[model samples]
Target: MSSNSNSNSGRRRPALLVLDLINEIVHPDGKYAADGYFAQARDRSVLERTAEAIARARAADIPVIYVVVGFSADYTEWPAGSPVFEKARADGRLKLGTWATQVHDALAPEPGEPVVAKHRISPFHGTNLELLLRTREIDTLLLTGVSTELVVLTTAQAGHDLDFRVQVLEDATLAGDAEIHAAALKVLSRIATVTTVEGALPSTG
Candidate 1:
């Protein structure tokens, strides 16, 4: 828990981190994806809703940050012998300077918006995200992104450990599988505020 105590502490608005909205689609085989379902698993609806959430956060004067996964062309920066590195080595996806590394058009960040590149499941692990958040004096976070069981879960755990108030936008994130998505949300709902996109909209105040 945060030691912060002040009348305005709880009311300070939360920043928004839209995670992994990049074009790097994973597990296209569907066999390796969640629930083994193809149609909804590949749909971009969740990304779109996350984009709307970012917009709302911006309108509320909250900072909006994006975290994406991408590696240098040769991926020499990936930890030696990592499974993700091995998979990318074979697939050759998310190469920097390639179209696949670009954030999706519908949810791309505008000029001057920060897009932090990460190689691990937790965006803040080796990135400047935590420093940036601290510099901005943000005490809460409105988390939304893909792979609820992966990136989203790792981030929430980190946020809780760092003493930031975290809220997982239920309808604004998706996993590769429906069951995986549901289970992740259930686990996260206990440790953080779990809310629907509409219910968590920025207040007009």
Candidate 2:
């Protein structure tokens, strides 16, 4: 279906989902960073692009939501010895008061935008992201963030399953696995609209 067709079919309000673009945490740099085909040096440009997208979304008056990873005082939610997280814990990473847990200041949401704490790949998985979006009467979600194949793709899949009108800003999302990112784009295009950051703009009134 066309983008408008999918959106207008049932969507009520527009919102933005900004995944974990916080700090330098990513699949390409931690315990999972060098695993198999995911191995690649983190791309600085991708992070900058995501920052740019966030700025644009805010300018458009689209409600923005941010997701970040942080652990409780005792790290209860983190599975003991899980390779993806254990290494970080051992290295003293993403602790509640640490720098890695903070959203990069350049792209931080404003006073009223919601911030969801996450423990896994999908921010919507263990967080109240869905409830916040619903409370805002938002039916359309524009996804923007780092590592497209991981957080972006996972959250997008979850959003699709939840029956939200999904639109991924192609330039706004990135990934360590080029193939995985490409595959995600193709599959998501089948289910949601894909547009460039420049293509989506603040509506002049």
TM-score per candidate, chains pooled: 0.86, 0.78
For model 2, the stretches where C-alpha displacement exceeds 4 angstroms are: 1-12, 26-44, 81-83, 202-205
Residue 67, candidate 2: how far off, in angstroms? Answer: 0.6
- Lowest-lDDT window of 10 residues in candidate 2? 35-44
Please give the distance, in angstroms, between residue 156's alpha carbon in candidate 2 and its true position after superposition. 1.1
TM-score for candidate 2, please give it: 0.78
**Cα-based lDDT at residue 45, candidate 2:** 54
What are the clashing pairs of model 2?
148-174
Candidate 2 per-residue C-alpha lDDT over 6-119 given as tens digits, one digit per residue, 9 for 90 to 100: 566674467877777666454444333454322322443554566666676677777888888778766777778675567666666666666666676667668887888888
Residue 12's lDDT within candidate 2 is 45
